[model samples]
Target: MSKNGSHFKVLFRPKAETFRGGCGECQTSCQSACKTSCTVGNQSCER
Candidate 1:
């Protein structure tokens, strides 16, 4: 039997999935909508 708490267990997870790459009109619209562009492609080359 395991004694791990639910709250603690909830925090553990596998690698987060990357955003779907869509460099179309929809993506452009979303970028414009956001106050600060947070997407990786727009900001830097590393990731």
Candidate 2:
């Protein structure tokens, strides 16, 4: 989280598998699935 309340660290907590959000552990109704590693705080992230 940043100074303001509009920022958050996008933690791509991969499940038992090696993928990020393709496994069943991902949010059941994830609307923002399979996106880049960037977050509100991270404008850019490595591939």
Count of steric clashes across candidates, in order: 0, 0
Question: In model 1, where do residues sit more than 4 Å from their true spots?
Answer: 1-7, 12-26, 35-47
lDDT of 2 by residue, 1-47 (tens): 66676576766865654443243453333234336333433232222
TM-score of each: 0.17, 0.17
TM-score of 1: 0.17
lDDT of 2 at 26: 35
- How big is the RMSD of model 1? 8.2
Error of 2 at 1 (Å): 1.8
Off by over 4 Å in 2: 2-10, 19-47
Please report, as a residue range, the 10-residue window in candidate 1 with the lowest summed lDDT: 38-47
- Candidate that scores best on TM-score: 1
Candidate 1, 27: how far from true, in Å? 2.5
Question: lDDT values of the candidates?
Answer: 0.44, 0.42
